[model samples]
Target: MSALLAASRASLRASKAPVMALRRSVHIENTVDNVLPFKAGKHNKGKVAVGVTAFFVTGLSLPLVAGLWQLYVPIAHARSK
Candidate 1:
């Protein structure tokens, strides 16, 4: 009887718990600092821009490449057959 009651309580808690969700992080401020000679202003603009662009492209490309690989595998297999 105790085992059955425990199982019921576990089910109730599982049902009540919230589902986990992924969240996108937001950057509100300049995270870079002391490491660089120039922390802010016009001098760092081009460098910062290129770094951000490279980071953004790498971030975007990874998922796209994975999805394309997933799509490509079936075509490759069928061609092999």
Candidate 2:
């Protein structure tokens, strides 16, 4: 999951540069429509941010629940020795 997020960040960064460059070259008259694609890029950023947070929180919580169970359950004990 971490690798996936890293790859996504890298991809976004790599693609953003050229789009920004394109923005600078376009005529000012239709600028709003010309830059419309970039607005979708911003939405992609939001989606990626949410995805990373969801994956991270779920990843951290699963092992924690197991660890707590091991600590509190008597019959599940291996640490008693």
Candidate 3:
């Protein structure tokens, strides 16, 4: 029983060093910066902003309009009846 406990403790201590080294090496400061798909240049800044805004507006409006149409259809049918 004592030999088994000593072997387990030795294995645990051996495993701990690699885990500590990994924790020290894996830091946010050492990490690479996230790459962007396109570079933001001065000439295309406005274009990028407009494109993003248009994308969000269209993306959001489509679902809203669809839901409003769905609500309106039921109301219209009830009124016609």
Best by TM-score: 3
| Candidate 2: C-alpha lDDT | 0.73
What is the alpha-carbon lDDT for the whole of candidate 1?
0.80
Candidate 1 local lDDT, 1-81, one digit each (tens): 999999999999888876553344643555554444455556777888888899999999999999999999999999999
* lDDT of candidates 1 onward, in order: 0.80, 0.73, 0.78
Model 1: per-residue Cα lDDT at residue 36: 47
Clashes of each: 0, 0, 0
Winner on TM-score (2 vs 3): 3
- The lDDT leader among the candidates is 1
Q: After superposition, how far is residue 34 of candidate 1 from its true place, in Å?
A: 7.1
Off by over 4 Å in 3: 1-35
lDDT tens readout by residue for model 3, 1-81: 999999999999888776556665633432233233554566677888998999999999999999999999999999999
Predicted structure 3, TM vs. truth:
0.50
- Number of residue pairs clashing in candidate 3, backbone atoms closer than 3 angstroms, sequence gap of 3 or more or interchain: 0
Scored against the true structure, residue 59 in model 1 reaches a CA lDDT of: 100
